[model samples]
Target: MKVAVLYEINKPLVIEEVTLPPLKYGQVLVKLKTSGLCHKQLEEMTGKRGHDPFLPHLLGHEGAGIVKDIGPGVSFVNKGDHVVLGWMKGKGINSEPPEYTNGRNKLNAGWITTFNEYGIYSENRVTSIKKEMPFDVACLLGCAVTTGYGVVNRIAKMESRKKVAVFGIGGIGLNVVQWASVRGATHVIAVDLRNDKLELARRIGATHVINAGNEHAVDAVRTITDGGADYVFEAAGNIHVMEQAYEATNGKGLTVLMGVPKKEDKLCIDPIPLYLGRRITGCHGGDTVKDEDIPLAVDLYLQGKLKLNELITERIHLSGINEAFQRMKEGKIVGRSIIEFERSSPD
Candidate 1:
């Protein structure tokens, strides 16, 4: 199989052929069909999170694939079953990660790396999907869509007609806006630095859009919400924007943090807000129970309640992964960008 390996920080991934290791207990070998390009991977590659103990390793946390074979003790998924690969642990066995060597040195990988054409992942990282969903769209069920929808459904627990402000309208933030719209939020304010994103947010569900580059995001959100929003979600991994997102929340409202920050990153906030009833919480994978939630998200999409198809802004082959990351870094993509592995043959 061919996989993208990160040998150093701030370097293009090395796409090379590798031999798959023997599958261990509770592991499943998957032929990846598609994978999502996420900001978290970009952060890891650029050293934003700092330090690389796993220097030469495979990266990518979310994907869609078929179950090529099952190892000992694997049961939930069978060979030929369509599945979604995610970083979050779900039901089933959590197997040890696989090791891939290039005959000289060994390369490291997590239990759920999907940058490769094929992978041996822990059973818990693979969720079986029975619906006839496109591989590219299904790949998003692994992270981008799930995280956004999970943030609203599982964390924010938004009430109908509530005022909402979503900071940074990327894949995750855009989903927050979409779900808020479906949940009937009276005012869904989408804040971002890009006009393209703001416009898309408006089309998806944002009742109001603010380009942070042109005006004060907090002030604009406050104006739209009539003072402050009842719920605010920060998906942009910017400390300044995170602070502003908190500021845009009402005194009695809730603020959810969906962005992963650097190890040295810190939030500055006044203690008086907490004492006055304002609450803040951090979300990991939107606190989603992946095994259960992935199916629910699929059902919503099938029922015409969710817009999964519209979330993918572009699709490219594995060879174009670096350019895709560059587009994400420049904030040029309006939604999720996916890697269509099926477009190329295995090495």
Candidate 2:
């Protein structure tokens, strides 16, 4: 199979032919149809996220594909089923409960993330896709969409008539805006440096848009929501934006940090506000329970209530993966950019 290999930090991924290992117990081999480019891939390429994985490792995280084969003991899905690559691989209902914890009981299951081609991104990756969806849409259900929806519905627990603010009007942020609006937020503020993105944010559901570059984001969000928003979500990984998100919330408002920040990056804030009942929480994979959420998102998409089509900005061939990353770095694309694969062999 042909996979895009990351040869070195700060270098372009090299596409190379490689042999895939046979599926193991409880694993399903999926013939990938589409994969989305995410900022984490960029961070991995530049070593911003820390040590690199194995040299020449396949690069891709968000993906969707068709099941080609199933290994022993796998019965969640069957061959020929269409599915999205899930990020939390090992941390599902089948996982084991943790033996020990600080105080509260917790599961020891490992998170399922799609970072490698077969692991997370590739023509054929390990997955258990449902039979009822398109590969392209299913792939997004793995990360971007799920993450955004998770922040709004799970972390913030947004309620009707509440004021909400979403910083960074990119893929995840746009979903946050739409979900908040759908939840009946009376005032939804979208903040971004780009006018084009702000426009898209409004079209999706933002009651107001703030150009973070032209005006102070914290002040702008405050102005829109009176004193402060009931909930604020920071989807941009930048530290400055994270601080702005914190400032945009009221004294007791909830701030959800959904973006993955660089390793070793520290956030500095006063102790007083934190003591004032304000809450800052972090979420992983949108706290998604795949068995529950993925199907719900799929149903929402099928109902036309969620705007999956509008989220997709472009579709490129698998060979165009590098170009897609370049465009993403240049901030020339919006929402999501997918790599659609064309089969080279029937087998």
Candidate 3:
């Protein structure tokens, strides 16, 4: 199979053909139909979290594919089943990470990898979805949509008519906006440096949009919500933006940090807020339960209640991944960039 290999940090991935070892216990072989390039992968590519012991490893966690084969002890899915592969664990066996070879050297991969034509994922990393669900959009359920949904419904337990503000209107952020709207939030404020993203957010559900590059984000959010938003989400993966999200919350509001900051970065906030009932917390993949959230998102999308298609702004082949990464880094991509594999057909 041809896979994108990250041999070094801050370097472009090398696309090459590699050989996959036979599947072990609780592993599943999948032929990828589509994959979503997430910001998490960009962090890995740039070494945002510091030294990577898994260099020369496969890159990608969210994808939709058909199960080509299943190893022993697997019961969650079977051969020919449509599945969404994600980083989060679900109900199944947690197999060992797979390793591929280029006939000379070995390459490492995590429990879930999608930047390849085919992948060997742990059973717990994949969940079967309806065949009717489009692969391009279903791939998003593997992370972005599921995480955003979890953030709103699970972690925050957001109530109706509450004022909400989301910082960084990217893939995950956009979903946060949509879910916030769907949950009946009276005011959904979208904040970002890119006007295009702000516009996209408006189209989805943001009652107001603020360009952080122009005016002060915290002040604008406070002004819009008449003192501050009830819930603030930081998804820009920048420490400064996370701070701004915290400041934009009301006296009794909760600030949720969804972005992954650099390893050396430390967040400093006023401790007085905690004493006054104001709170700040970070989310791990939105506290999403993969087995539950993925299926629910699929049902919502199929029912025309969830906005998945709008989240997909661009679809590129595997070869164009680097270019897509550049666009995402520059904030040129208003939404998710899906990698459409050549052999997308389930057959």
Worst 10 residues of 1 by lDDT: 338-347
Global lDDT scores for all candidate models: 0.88, 0.71, 0.91
| Per-residue alpha-carbon lDDT of candidate 2 for residues 159-243, written as tens digits (9 for 90 to 100) | 7889999998877889889889878899999999899999888877899999988998898788888889989999888888888
Highest-scoring model, lDDT: 3
| Better structure of 1 and 2 per TM-score | 1
Kindly list the per-residue Cα lDDT of model 1 for residues 188-272, writing each as its tens digit.
Answer: 9999888888888887789998989999888888888888999999988888878998899999999998877777999998769
Give the runs in model 3 whose Cα sits over 4 Å from its true position.
Answer: 262-273, 343-347
List the candidates ranked by TM-score, beginning with the highest: 3, 1, 2
Residue ranges of candidate 1 with Cα displaced over 4 Å:
260-276, 344-347
Against the correct fold, how does model 1 do in TM-score? 0.92
True-vs-predicted CA distance for residue 206, candidate 1, Å: 1.4
Write one digit per residue (lDDT tens) for candidate 3, span 304-333. 888788888888888888888988788777
User: RMSD of candidate 3 to the true fold?
Assistant: 2.7
Candidate 3 backbone overlaps, count? 0
